[model samples]
Target: MTNEKRLPPLLKLALELGPLALFFVANAYADRFGFAEGQRIFFATALFIGATLVALAVSYALLRKLPIMPLVSGVVVVVFGGLTLFLQDETFIKLKPTIVNTMFGAILLGGLYFRKPLLEIVLDSVFDLTEEGWRKLTLRWALFFFTLAALNEIVWRTQSTDFWVSFKVFGIMPLTIAFALAQTPLLLRHEAKKAEEA
Candidate 1:
Protein backbone atom coordinates (compact mmCIF):
# COMPACT_ATOMS: atom_id res chain seq x y z
CA MET A 1 0.00 0.00 0.00
CA THR A 2 2.75 2.36 -0.86
CA ASN A 3 0.19 4.27 -2.86
CA GLU A 4 -2.37 4.63 -0.09
CA LYS A 5 -2.78 8.17 1.21
CA ARG A 6 -1.75 8.79 4.79
CA LEU A 7 -2.59 11.73 7.03
CA PRO A 8 0.29 12.83 9.20
CA PRO A 9 -0.15 11.42 12.72
CA LEU A 10 -0.78 14.69 14.55
CA LEU A 11 -3.21 15.96 11.90
CA LYS A 12 -5.01 12.63 11.99
CA LEU A 13 -5.26 12.82 15.78
CA ALA A 14 -6.65 16.33 15.64
CA LEU A 15 -9.20 15.45 12.98
CA GLU A 16 -10.48 12.60 15.13
CA LEU A 17 -10.12 13.98 18.65
CA GLY A 18 -10.82 17.67 18.15
CA PRO A 19 -14.58 17.21 17.88
CA LEU A 20 -14.74 15.24 21.08
CA ALA A 21 -12.69 17.89 22.85
CA LEU A 22 -15.08 20.55 21.65
CA PHE A 23 -18.04 18.50 22.84
CA PHE A 24 -16.53 18.16 26.30
CA VAL A 25 -15.69 21.82 26.58
CA ALA A 26 -19.06 22.96 25.27
CA ASN A 27 -20.92 20.83 27.80
CA ALA A 28 -18.72 22.00 30.67
CA TYR A 29 -19.22 25.65 29.88
CA ALA A 30 -22.84 25.56 28.74
CA ASP A 31 -23.92 26.52 32.24
CA ARG A 32 -21.63 29.51 32.31
CA PHE A 33 -23.06 30.56 28.98
CA GLY A 34 -26.58 30.71 30.45
CA PHE A 35 -28.07 27.42 29.36
CA ALA A 36 -30.73 26.04 31.65
CA GLU A 37 -30.02 23.28 34.16
CA GLY A 38 -31.20 20.44 31.95
CA GLN A 39 -30.21 21.92 28.57
CA ARG A 40 -26.44 21.79 28.57
CA ILE A 41 -26.34 18.45 26.84
CA PHE A 42 -28.26 19.95 23.93
CA PHE A 43 -25.68 22.69 23.67
CA ALA A 44 -22.98 20.10 23.58
CA THR A 45 -24.85 17.99 21.05
CA ALA A 46 -25.12 20.91 18.67
CA LEU A 47 -21.41 21.63 18.90
CA PHE A 48 -20.58 17.95 18.52
CA ILE A 49 -22.59 17.83 15.31
CA GLY A 50 -20.94 20.89 13.85
CA ALA A 51 -17.44 19.87 14.91
CA THR A 52 -17.85 16.38 13.47
CA LEU A 53 -18.96 17.82 10.14
CA VAL A 54 -16.01 20.20 10.09
CA ALA A 55 -13.63 17.40 10.89
CA LEU A 56 -14.99 15.24 8.08
CA ALA A 57 -14.65 18.10 5.61
CA VAL A 58 -11.08 18.74 6.69
CA SER A 59 -10.28 15.03 6.38
CA TYR A 60 -11.74 14.88 2.88
CA ALA A 61 -9.71 17.94 1.88
CA LEU A 62 -6.46 16.47 3.18
CA LEU A 63 -6.86 12.82 2.12
CA ARG A 64 -9.22 13.16 -0.85
CA LYS A 65 -11.33 10.52 0.94
CA LEU A 66 -12.83 9.96 4.34
CA PRO A 67 -11.60 7.13 6.54
CA ILE A 68 -14.22 4.45 6.99
CA MET A 69 -14.55 4.39 10.78
CA PRO A 70 -14.62 8.13 11.33
CA LEU A 71 -16.97 8.64 8.42
CA VAL A 72 -19.42 6.13 9.90
CA SER A 73 -19.04 7.59 13.39
CA GLY A 74 -19.56 11.10 12.07
CA VAL A 75 -22.78 10.11 10.36
CA VAL A 76 -24.10 8.59 13.57
CA VAL A 77 -23.14 11.64 15.58
CA VAL A 78 -24.93 13.98 13.25
CA VAL A 79 -28.08 11.89 13.20
CA PHE A 80 -28.30 11.16 16.90
CA GLY A 81 -27.02 14.54 17.94
CA GLY A 82 -29.66 16.17 15.78
CA LEU A 83 -32.34 14.06 17.43
CA THR A 84 -31.03 14.95 20.86
CA LEU A 85 -31.23 18.65 20.18
CA PHE A 86 -34.52 18.50 18.32
CA LEU A 87 -36.38 16.39 20.83
CA GLN A 88 -34.86 18.19 23.78
CA ASP A 89 -33.79 14.84 25.13
CA GLU A 90 -30.26 13.91 26.10
CA THR A 91 -30.94 10.17 25.76
CA PHE A 92 -30.29 10.14 22.02
CA ILE A 93 -26.86 11.73 22.30
CA LYS A 94 -26.00 9.41 25.15
CA LEU A 95 -27.06 6.42 23.07
CA LYS A 96 -24.85 7.51 20.16
CA PRO A 97 -21.74 5.70 21.38
CA THR A 98 -23.57 2.46 22.13
CA ILE A 99 -25.10 2.49 18.67
CA VAL A 100 -21.87 3.36 16.86
CA ASN A 101 -19.79 0.82 18.75
CA THR A 102 -22.31 -1.96 18.35
CA MET A 103 -22.64 -1.18 14.64
CA PHE A 104 -18.87 -1.41 14.17
CA GLY A 105 -18.66 -4.63 16.16
CA ALA A 106 -21.43 -6.20 14.17
CA ILE A 107 -19.96 -5.09 10.86
CA LEU A 108 -16.55 -6.56 11.72
CA LEU A 109 -18.01 -9.83 12.94
CA GLY A 110 -20.25 -10.06 9.91
CA GLY A 111 -17.28 -9.51 7.63
CA LEU A 112 -15.43 -12.32 9.37
CA TYR A 113 -18.42 -14.61 9.04
CA PHE A 114 -18.09 -14.24 5.28
CA ARG A 115 -14.29 -14.57 5.52
CA LYS A 116 -13.87 -11.07 4.13
CA PRO A 117 -11.48 -9.51 6.73
CA LEU A 118 -12.79 -6.01 6.14
CA LEU A 119 -10.45 -4.40 8.62
CA GLU A 120 -7.77 -4.76 5.97
CA ILE A 121 -9.76 -2.49 3.70
CA VAL A 122 -9.79 0.20 6.36
CA LEU A 123 -6.31 -0.33 7.81
CA ASP A 124 -4.19 -1.37 4.81
CA SER A 125 -2.29 1.88 4.84
CA VAL A 126 -1.24 1.36 8.46
CA PHE A 127 -0.40 -2.34 8.47
CA ASP A 128 0.22 -5.14 6.04
CA LEU A 129 -0.86 -8.43 7.60
CA THR A 130 -1.35 -12.02 6.50
CA GLU A 131 -4.89 -13.36 6.16
CA GLU A 132 -4.67 -15.15 9.51
CA GLY A 133 -3.37 -12.01 11.11
CA TRP A 134 -6.24 -10.01 9.66
CA ARG A 135 -8.77 -12.49 10.95
CA LYS A 136 -7.32 -12.57 14.46
CA LEU A 137 -6.97 -8.81 14.57
CA THR A 138 -10.52 -8.25 13.29
CA LEU A 139 -11.98 -10.63 15.86
CA ARG A 140 -10.14 -8.89 18.66
CA TRP A 141 -11.35 -5.49 17.47
CA ALA A 142 -14.92 -6.74 17.15
CA LEU A 143 -14.86 -7.95 20.74
CA PHE A 144 -13.33 -4.71 21.93
CA PHE A 145 -16.03 -2.66 20.20
CA PHE A 146 -18.77 -4.74 21.80
CA THR A 147 -17.16 -4.19 25.18
CA LEU A 148 -17.13 -0.45 24.56
CA ALA A 149 -20.81 -0.53 23.59
CA ALA A 150 -21.72 -2.31 26.80
CA LEU A 151 -19.61 0.07 28.84
CA ASN A 152 -21.32 3.08 27.26
CA GLU A 153 -24.73 1.65 28.01
CA ILE A 154 -23.79 1.10 31.65
CA VAL A 155 -22.26 4.52 32.20
CA TRP A 156 -24.94 6.65 30.53
CA ARG A 157 -27.87 4.85 32.10
CA THR A 158 -26.39 5.08 35.59
CA GLN A 159 -24.48 8.35 35.62
CA SER A 160 -25.20 12.06 35.29
CA THR A 161 -24.83 13.93 32.01
CA ASP A 162 -21.69 15.73 33.20
CA PHE A 163 -20.17 12.47 34.31
CA TRP A 164 -21.04 10.82 31.00
CA VAL A 165 -19.52 13.71 29.06
CA SER A 166 -16.32 13.47 31.06
CA PHE A 167 -16.22 9.69 30.64
CA LYS A 168 -16.70 9.95 26.88
CA VAL A 169 -13.66 12.19 26.48
CA PHE A 170 -11.38 11.14 29.33
CA GLY A 171 -12.29 7.52 29.97
CA ILE A 172 -13.39 5.91 26.69
CA MET A 173 -10.75 7.67 24.59
CA PRO A 174 -7.94 6.44 26.85
CA LEU A 175 -9.32 2.91 26.88
CA THR A 176 -9.51 2.86 23.07
CA ILE A 177 -5.97 4.21 22.62
CA ALA A 178 -4.58 1.75 25.17
CA PHE A 179 -6.34 -1.20 23.55
CA ALA A 180 -5.13 -0.24 20.06
CA LEU A 181 -1.55 0.23 21.27
CA ALA A 182 -1.69 -3.16 23.02
CA GLN A 183 -2.24 -4.80 19.61
CA THR A 184 1.29 -3.82 18.53
CA PRO A 185 2.77 -7.26 19.18
CA LEU A 186 0.10 -9.02 17.16
CA LEU A 187 0.53 -6.50 14.38
CA LEU A 188 4.31 -6.97 14.45
CA ARG A 189 4.19 -10.74 14.63
CA HIS A 190 1.94 -11.13 11.62
CA GLU A 191 3.20 -8.31 9.46
CA ALA A 192 3.49 -9.22 5.78
CA LYS A 193 6.83 -8.68 4.05
CA LYS A 194 7.13 -7.48 0.49
CA ALA A 195 9.39 -9.15 -2.08
CA GLU A 196 12.67 -7.44 -2.87
CA GLU A 197 12.90 -5.44 -6.11
CA ALA A 198 14.69 -7.27 -8.91
Candidate 2:
Protein backbone atom coordinates (compact mmCIF):
# COMPACT_ATOMS: atom_id res chain seq x y z
CA MET A 1 0.00 0.00 0.00
CA THR A 2 2.94 2.27 -0.55
CA ASN A 3 3.13 4.17 -3.77
CA GLU A 4 5.43 7.05 -2.98
CA LYS A 5 4.35 9.27 -5.83
CA ARG A 6 1.24 11.36 -5.42
CA LEU A 7 -1.35 12.09 -8.09
CA PRO A 8 -0.90 15.62 -9.36
CA PRO A 9 -3.50 18.27 -8.71
CA LEU A 10 -4.15 18.64 -12.42
CA LEU A 11 -5.31 15.04 -12.53
CA LYS A 12 -7.93 15.83 -9.93
CA LEU A 13 -8.99 18.86 -11.94
CA ALA A 14 -9.22 16.71 -15.05
CA LEU A 15 -11.51 14.28 -13.28
CA GLU A 16 -13.84 17.18 -12.59
CA LEU A 17 -13.47 18.85 -15.99
CA GLY A 18 -13.87 15.70 -18.05
CA PRO A 19 -17.63 15.54 -17.53
CA LEU A 20 -18.05 19.24 -18.30
CA ALA A 21 -16.16 18.82 -21.53
CA LEU A 22 -18.38 15.92 -22.41
CA PHE A 23 -21.42 18.06 -21.74
CA PHE A 24 -20.20 20.87 -24.01
CA VAL A 25 -19.19 18.51 -26.76
CA ALA A 26 -22.52 16.71 -26.64
CA ASN A 27 -24.44 19.97 -26.58
CA ALA A 28 -22.55 21.07 -29.67
CA TYR A 29 -23.74 17.97 -31.50
CA ALA A 30 -27.19 17.35 -30.05
CA ASP A 31 -29.08 19.04 -32.89
CA ARG A 32 -27.89 16.40 -35.33
CA PHE A 33 -29.92 13.99 -33.23
CA GLY A 34 -33.05 16.18 -33.55
CA PHE A 35 -32.63 18.18 -30.35
CA ALA A 36 -33.43 21.88 -30.41
CA GLU A 37 -31.61 24.38 -28.22
CA GLY A 38 -33.72 23.64 -25.15
CA GLN A 39 -33.69 19.93 -25.75
CA ARG A 40 -30.01 20.12 -26.44
CA ILE A 41 -29.35 21.81 -23.14
CA PHE A 42 -31.46 19.23 -21.34
CA PHE A 43 -29.70 16.37 -23.01
CA ALA A 44 -26.36 18.01 -22.39
CA THR A 45 -27.12 18.21 -18.71
CA ALA A 46 -28.38 14.63 -18.69
CA LEU A 47 -25.19 13.68 -20.41
CA PHE A 48 -23.23 15.47 -17.73
CA ILE A 49 -25.14 13.63 -15.05
CA GLY A 50 -24.44 10.40 -16.85
CA ALA A 51 -20.78 11.31 -17.02
CA THR A 52 -20.82 12.05 -13.31
CA LEU A 53 -22.26 8.62 -12.64
CA VAL A 54 -19.59 7.05 -14.76
CA ALA A 55 -16.96 9.02 -12.91
CA LEU A 56 -18.44 7.92 -9.61
CA ALA A 57 -18.32 4.35 -10.78
CA VAL A 58 -14.68 4.69 -11.72
CA SER A 59 -13.87 6.51 -8.49
CA TYR A 60 -15.46 3.72 -6.49
CA ALA A 61 -13.62 1.14 -8.49
CA LEU A 62 -10.36 2.87 -7.74
CA LEU A 63 -10.92 4.52 -4.35
CA ARG A 64 -14.39 3.42 -3.21
CA LYS A 65 -17.37 5.66 -2.48
CA LEU A 66 -17.08 9.22 -3.87
CA PRO A 67 -14.74 12.12 -3.43
CA ILE A 68 -16.28 14.63 -1.07
CA MET A 69 -16.36 17.68 -3.36
CA PRO A 70 -17.52 15.72 -6.42
CA LEU A 71 -20.16 13.99 -4.30
CA VAL A 72 -21.70 17.35 -3.45
CA SER A 73 -21.59 18.39 -7.10
CA GLY A 74 -23.19 15.10 -8.10
CA VAL A 75 -26.06 15.54 -5.65
CA VAL A 76 -26.87 19.01 -7.03
CA VAL A 77 -26.60 17.69 -10.57
CA VAL A 78 -29.22 15.04 -9.83
CA VAL A 79 -31.50 17.49 -8.10
CA PHE A 80 -31.35 20.03 -10.91
CA GLY A 81 -31.31 17.32 -13.51
CA GLY A 82 -34.65 16.09 -12.24
CA LEU A 83 -36.10 19.55 -12.56
CA THR A 84 -34.77 19.90 -16.09
CA LEU A 85 -36.47 16.68 -17.15
CA PHE A 86 -39.74 17.29 -15.28
CA LEU A 87 -40.19 20.85 -16.42
CA GLN A 88 -38.79 20.23 -19.87
CA ASP A 89 -36.78 23.42 -19.78
CA GLU A 90 -33.10 23.86 -20.36
CA THR A 91 -32.60 26.95 -18.20
CA PHE A 92 -32.85 24.81 -15.10
CA ILE A 93 -30.11 22.63 -16.43
CA LYS A 94 -27.99 25.63 -17.37
CA LEU A 95 -28.28 27.01 -13.85
CA LYS A 96 -27.29 23.77 -12.17
CA PRO A 97 -23.60 24.58 -11.88
CA THR A 98 -24.31 28.05 -10.64
CA ILE A 99 -26.54 26.69 -7.91
CA VAL A 100 -24.01 24.10 -6.83
CA ASN A 101 -21.16 26.55 -6.77
CA THR A 102 -23.14 29.16 -4.89
CA MET A 103 -24.19 26.67 -2.26
CA PHE A 104 -20.65 25.43 -1.87
CA GLY A 105 -19.34 28.96 -1.49
CA ALA A 106 -21.93 29.88 1.07
CA ILE A 107 -21.43 26.74 3.09
CA LEU A 108 -17.69 27.05 3.13
CA LEU A 109 -17.76 30.71 4.06
CA GLY A 110 -20.39 30.13 6.69
CA GLY A 111 -18.16 27.62 8.45
CA LEU A 112 -15.96 30.54 9.45
CA TYR A 113 -18.70 31.63 11.80
CA PHE A 114 -17.90 28.57 13.88
CA ARG A 115 -14.14 29.11 13.55
CA LYS A 116 -13.84 25.98 11.48
CA PRO A 117 -12.41 25.41 8.05
CA LEU A 118 -14.92 22.86 6.84
CA LEU A 119 -13.31 22.87 3.43
CA GLU A 120 -10.51 20.86 4.96
CA ILE A 121 -12.88 17.97 5.20
CA VAL A 122 -13.11 17.80 1.44
CA LEU A 123 -9.60 18.96 0.51
CA ASP A 124 -7.48 17.35 3.17
CA SER A 125 -7.05 14.22 1.10
CA VAL A 126 -5.49 16.32 -1.62
CA PHE A 127 -3.63 19.04 0.19
CA ASP A 128 -2.43 19.98 3.63
CA LEU A 129 -2.42 23.43 5.12
CA THR A 130 -2.14 24.98 8.53
CA GLU A 131 -5.38 26.05 10.16
CA GLU A 132 -4.94 29.69 9.20
CA GLY A 133 -3.78 28.70 5.77
CA TRP A 134 -6.91 26.67 5.29
CA ARG A 135 -9.13 29.48 6.49
CA LYS A 136 -7.65 32.02 4.08
CA LEU A 137 -7.73 29.55 1.23
CA THR A 138 -11.33 28.68 1.98
CA LEU A 139 -12.34 32.31 2.08
CA ARG A 140 -10.82 33.00 -1.30
CA TRP A 141 -12.50 30.01 -2.85
CA ALA A 142 -15.84 31.00 -1.38
CA LEU A 143 -15.62 34.42 -2.91
CA PHE A 144 -14.41 32.97 -6.17
CA PHE A 145 -17.43 30.70 -6.51
CA PHE A 146 -19.77 33.51 -5.65
CA THR A 147 -18.20 35.66 -8.32
CA LEU A 148 -18.40 32.84 -10.80
CA ALA A 149 -22.10 32.50 -10.15
CA ALA A 150 -22.63 36.18 -10.68
CA LEU A 151 -20.67 36.08 -13.89
CA ASN A 152 -22.62 33.09 -15.10
CA GLU A 153 -25.88 34.88 -14.49
CA ILE A 154 -24.72 37.93 -16.33
CA VAL A 155 -23.39 36.08 -19.34
CA TRP A 156 -26.33 33.76 -19.81
CA ARG A 157 -28.80 36.58 -19.34
CA THR A 158 -27.36 39.27 -21.57
CA GLN A 159 -25.63 37.31 -24.29
CA SER A 160 -27.14 35.57 -27.27
CA THR A 161 -27.62 31.82 -26.84
CA ASP A 162 -24.79 31.07 -29.20
CA PHE A 163 -22.56 33.51 -27.36
CA TRP A 164 -23.45 31.98 -24.02
CA VAL A 165 -22.73 28.53 -25.30
CA SER A 166 -19.41 29.71 -26.63
CA PHE A 167 -18.64 31.32 -23.29
CA LYS A 168 -19.25 28.07 -21.48
CA VAL A 169 -16.88 26.18 -23.69
CA PHE A 170 -14.24 28.83 -24.32
CA GLY A 171 -14.44 31.62 -21.78
CA ILE A 172 -15.39 29.90 -18.55
CA MET A 173 -13.36 26.77 -19.08
CA PRO A 174 -10.19 28.69 -19.80
CA LEU A 175 -10.71 31.01 -16.87
CA THR A 176 -11.20 28.07 -14.55
CA ILE A 177 -8.05 26.38 -15.77
CA ALA A 178 -6.10 29.60 -15.38
CA PHE A 179 -7.44 30.06 -11.89
CA ALA A 180 -6.50 26.52 -10.94
CA LEU A 181 -3.06 26.94 -12.37
CA ALA A 182 -2.59 30.12 -10.36
CA GLN A 183 -3.28 28.18 -7.19
CA THR A 184 -0.39 25.81 -7.66
CA PRO A 185 2.24 28.23 -6.39
CA LEU A 186 0.21 28.78 -3.25
CA LEU A 187 -0.15 25.07 -2.81
CA LEU A 188 3.55 24.55 -3.21
CA ARG A 189 4.35 27.30 -0.73
CA HIS A 190 2.07 25.59 1.75
CA GLU A 191 3.40 22.17 0.87
CA ALA A 192 5.73 21.93 3.86
CA LYS A 193 3.33 20.17 6.18
CA LYS A 194 1.77 18.16 3.41
CA ALA A 195 5.13 16.97 2.23
CA GLU A 196 6.03 15.84 5.71
CA GLU A 197 2.69 14.17 6.19
CA ALA A 198 2.84 12.49 2.84
Candidate 3:
Protein backbone atom coordinates (compact mmCIF):
# COMPACT_ATOMS: atom_id res chain seq x y z
CA MET A 1 0.00 0.00 0.00
CA THR A 2 1.06 3.52 -0.67
CA ASN A 3 1.79 6.08 2.05
CA GLU A 4 -0.29 8.90 0.66
CA LYS A 5 -2.07 10.91 3.38
CA ARG A 6 -2.60 14.43 2.16
CA LEU A 7 -6.06 15.71 1.28
CA PRO A 8 -6.99 17.00 -2.16
CA PRO A 9 -6.69 20.73 -2.74
CA LEU A 10 -10.41 21.42 -3.06
CA LEU A 11 -11.19 19.61 0.16
CA LYS A 12 -8.49 21.59 1.85
CA LEU A 13 -10.10 24.77 0.57
CA ALA A 14 -13.46 23.74 1.97
CA LEU A 15 -11.98 23.02 5.36
CA GLU A 16 -10.28 26.37 5.32
CA LEU A 17 -13.53 28.13 4.49
CA GLY A 18 -15.38 26.26 7.22
CA PRO A 19 -14.28 28.56 10.02
CA LEU A 20 -15.65 31.65 8.32
CA ALA A 21 -18.94 29.82 7.95
CA LEU A 22 -18.88 29.02 11.65
CA PHE A 23 -18.11 32.62 12.55
CA PHE A 24 -21.11 33.83 10.58
CA VAL A 25 -23.32 31.22 12.18
CA ALA A 26 -22.16 32.10 15.67
CA ASN A 27 -22.77 35.79 15.05
CA ALA A 28 -26.24 35.14 13.66
CA TYR A 29 -27.19 33.03 16.65
CA ALA A 30 -25.69 35.33 19.24
CA ASP A 31 -28.96 36.25 20.91
CA ARG A 32 -29.93 32.64 21.55
CA PHE A 33 -27.02 32.27 23.93
CA GLY A 34 -28.51 34.88 26.28
CA PHE A 35 -25.39 36.95 26.15
CA ALA A 36 -25.49 40.72 26.74
CA GLU A 37 -24.88 42.81 23.66
CA GLY A 38 -21.27 43.36 24.60
CA GLN A 39 -20.94 39.83 25.86
CA ARG A 40 -22.46 38.43 22.71
CA ILE A 41 -20.03 40.32 20.58
CA PHE A 42 -17.13 39.13 22.71
CA PHE A 43 -18.39 35.57 22.74
CA ALA A 44 -18.87 35.54 19.01
CA THR A 45 -15.45 36.96 18.49
CA ALA A 46 -14.00 34.28 20.74
CA LEU A 47 -15.78 31.59 18.81
CA PHE A 48 -14.57 32.98 15.53
CA ILE A 49 -11.04 33.03 16.78
CA GLY A 50 -11.31 29.49 18.07
CA ALA A 51 -12.90 28.30 14.85
CA THR A 52 -10.09 29.79 12.81
CA LEU A 53 -7.46 28.16 14.98
CA VAL A 54 -9.21 24.83 14.70
CA ALA A 55 -9.52 25.21 10.94
CA LEU A 56 -5.85 26.03 10.72
CA ALA A 57 -4.98 22.93 12.68
CA VAL A 58 -7.17 20.74 10.52
CA SER A 59 -5.74 22.23 7.37
CA TYR A 60 -2.22 21.60 8.57
CA ALA A 61 -3.08 18.00 9.40
CA LEU A 62 -4.52 17.45 5.95
CA LEU A 63 -1.93 19.32 3.93
CA ARG A 64 1.24 18.79 6.02
CA LYS A 65 1.75 22.55 6.31
CA LEU A 66 -0.26 25.70 6.84
CA PRO A 67 -1.42 27.40 3.68
CA ILE A 68 0.23 30.81 3.77
CA MET A 69 -2.75 32.93 2.75
CA PRO A 70 -5.11 31.21 5.17
CA LEU A 71 -2.50 31.47 7.90
CA VAL A 72 -2.31 35.20 7.29
CA SER A 73 -6.07 35.39 7.28
CA GLY A 74 -6.24 33.47 10.53
CA VAL A 75 -3.76 35.82 12.15
CA VAL A 76 -5.99 38.72 11.22
CA VAL A 77 -8.98 36.90 12.63
CA VAL A 78 -7.31 36.40 15.95
CA VAL A 79 -5.92 39.91 16.13
CA PHE A 80 -9.16 41.64 15.19
CA GLY A 81 -10.97 39.15 17.34
CA GLY A 82 -8.91 40.15 20.34
CA LEU A 83 -9.48 43.80 19.63
CA THR A 84 -13.23 43.29 19.29
CA LEU A 85 -13.41 41.44 22.57
CA PHE A 86 -11.28 44.01 24.37
CA LEU A 87 -13.22 46.93 23.02
CA GLN A 88 -16.55 45.08 23.23
CA ASP A 89 -17.42 46.37 19.80
CA GLU A 90 -18.74 44.61 16.71
CA THR A 91 -17.18 47.18 14.46
CA PHE A 92 -13.68 45.80 14.89
CA ILE A 93 -14.75 42.31 13.94
CA LYS A 94 -16.71 43.59 10.99
CA LEU A 95 -13.82 45.63 9.71
CA LYS A 96 -11.46 42.64 9.76
CA PRO A 97 -12.29 41.57 6.23
CA THR A 98 -11.80 45.05 4.87
CA ILE A 99 -8.40 45.30 6.47
CA VAL A 100 -7.38 41.86 5.27
CA ASN A 101 -8.58 42.25 1.69
CA THR A 102 -7.12 45.71 1.42
CA MET A 103 -3.81 44.53 2.77
CA PHE A 104 -3.72 41.63 0.33
CA GLY A 105 -4.56 43.93 -2.55
CA ALA A 106 -1.85 46.37 -1.61
CA ILE A 107 0.79 43.69 -1.31
CA LEU A 108 -0.24 42.12 -4.61
CA LEU A 109 -0.33 45.37 -6.55
CA GLY A 110 2.87 46.53 -4.93
CA GLY A 111 4.61 43.33 -5.96
CA LEU A 112 3.77 44.18 -9.54
CA TYR A 113 5.47 47.51 -9.01
CA PHE A 114 8.66 45.66 -8.13
CA ARG A 115 8.39 43.46 -11.24
CA LYS A 116 7.37 40.44 -9.21
CA PRO A 117 4.23 38.32 -9.29
CA LEU A 118 3.56 37.23 -5.73
CA LEU A 119 0.59 35.01 -6.55
CA GLU A 120 2.86 32.49 -8.19
CA ILE A 121 4.65 31.95 -4.91
CA VAL A 122 1.44 31.41 -2.93
CA LEU A 123 -0.37 29.34 -5.59
CA ASP A 124 2.62 27.50 -6.96
CA SER A 125 1.49 24.14 -5.67
CA VAL A 126 -1.96 24.43 -7.25
CA PHE A 127 -0.97 25.91 -10.60
CA ASP A 128 2.14 26.21 -12.67
CA LEU A 129 2.58 29.15 -15.04
CA THR A 130 5.26 31.38 -16.48
CA GLU A 131 6.10 34.84 -15.18
CA GLU A 132 3.75 36.75 -17.48
CA GLY A 133 0.92 34.35 -16.80
CA TRP A 134 1.55 34.67 -13.09
CA ARG A 135 1.54 38.43 -13.35
CA LYS A 136 -1.85 38.52 -15.05
CA LEU A 137 -3.30 35.98 -12.68
CA THR A 138 -1.97 37.89 -9.68
CA LEU A 139 -3.46 41.15 -10.93
CA ARG A 140 -6.85 39.52 -11.41
CA TRP A 141 -6.89 38.15 -7.89
CA ALA A 142 -5.73 41.48 -6.46
CA LEU A 143 -8.59 43.27 -8.15
CA PHE A 144 -11.11 40.64 -7.13
CA PHE A 145 -10.11 40.83 -3.46
CA PHE A 146 -10.24 44.63 -3.49
CA THR A 147 -13.68 44.48 -5.07
CA LEU A 148 -14.78 42.15 -2.29
CA ALA A 149 -13.53 44.63 0.30
CA ALA A 150 -15.49 47.44 -1.30
CA LEU A 151 -18.61 45.31 -1.50
CA ASN A 152 -18.26 44.37 2.16
CA GLU A 153 -18.14 48.03 3.13
CA ILE A 154 -21.19 48.76 1.00
CA VAL A 155 -23.22 45.86 2.42
CA TRP A 156 -22.31 46.48 6.04
CA ARG A 157 -22.94 50.19 5.73
CA THR A 158 -26.36 49.93 4.03
CA GLN A 159 -27.90 46.58 4.92
CA SER A 160 -29.29 44.89 7.97
CA THR A 161 -27.16 42.40 9.86
CA ASP A 162 -29.30 39.56 8.58
CA PHE A 163 -28.87 40.73 5.01
CA TRP A 164 -25.11 41.03 5.39
CA VAL A 165 -24.95 37.53 6.84
CA SER A 166 -26.89 36.16 3.89
CA PHE A 167 -24.73 38.07 1.44
CA LYS A 168 -21.55 36.90 3.15
CA VAL A 169 -22.63 33.32 2.63
CA PHE A 170 -24.67 33.34 -0.58
CA GLY A 171 -23.33 36.39 -2.37
CA ILE A 172 -19.55 36.20 -1.97
CA MET A 173 -19.33 32.45 -2.53
CA PRO A 174 -21.17 32.59 -5.84
CA LEU A 175 -19.02 35.46 -6.95
CA THR A 176 -15.99 33.37 -6.20
CA ILE A 177 -17.38 30.46 -8.19
CA ALA A 178 -18.19 32.65 -11.14
CA PHE A 179 -14.81 34.31 -11.01
CA ALA A 180 -13.02 30.95 -10.89
CA LEU A 181 -15.11 29.70 -13.78
CA ALA A 182 -14.04 32.71 -15.79
CA GLN A 183 -10.47 31.58 -15.32
CA THR A 184 -11.11 28.13 -16.77
CA PRO A 185 -9.65 29.01 -20.15
CA LEU A 186 -6.45 30.09 -18.49
CA LEU A 187 -6.19 26.89 -16.49
CA LEU A 188 -7.00 24.76 -19.50
CA ARG A 189 -4.38 26.40 -21.67
CA HIS A 190 -1.67 25.67 -19.15
CA GLU A 191 -3.04 22.20 -18.47
CA ALA A 192 -2.97 21.42 -22.20
CA LYS A 193 0.58 22.57 -22.51
CA LYS A 194 1.62 20.42 -19.54
CA ALA A 195 -0.10 17.47 -21.19
CA GLU A 196 1.77 18.06 -24.44
CA GLU A 197 5.10 18.36 -22.69
CA ALA A 198 4.48 15.21 -20.71
Best by TM-score: 1
The TM-score between candidate 2 and the true structure equals 0.82
Ranking by lDDT: 1, 3, 2
* CA lDDT, candidate 2, residue 107: 93
Better of 1 and 3 by TM-score: 1
Per-residue alpha-carbon lDDT of candidate 3 for residues 63-104, written as tens digits (9 for 90 to 100): 688867889889999998888888777677778878888989
RMSD of each: 2.2, 3.8, 3.6
- Where is the poorest 10-residue window by lDDT in model 3? 1-10
Candidate 1 on 1-198: residue-level lDDT in tens? 758778899998998999999999999999999998798889988999999999999999988998889999999999999989888889999999999999999999999999998999988877888888999999999999999999999999999999999999999999999999999999877877731221
Cα error, residue 88 of model 2, in Å, equals 1.1
For model 3, the stretches where C-alpha displacement exceeds 4 angstroms are 1-6, 36-41, 62-64, 190-198
TM-score on alpha carbons, each prediction: 0.95, 0.82, 0.85
Q: lDDT: which is higher, 2 or 3?
A: 3
Whole-model lDDT, model 3: 0.79
Sort the candidates on TM-score, descending order: 1, 3, 2
Which candidate do you rate higher for lDDT, 1 or 2?
Answer: 1
Best by lDDT: 1
> Cα deviation in Å at residue 14, candidate 2?
4.7
Which regions of candidate 2 fall more than 4 Å away from where they truly are? 1-14, 188-198
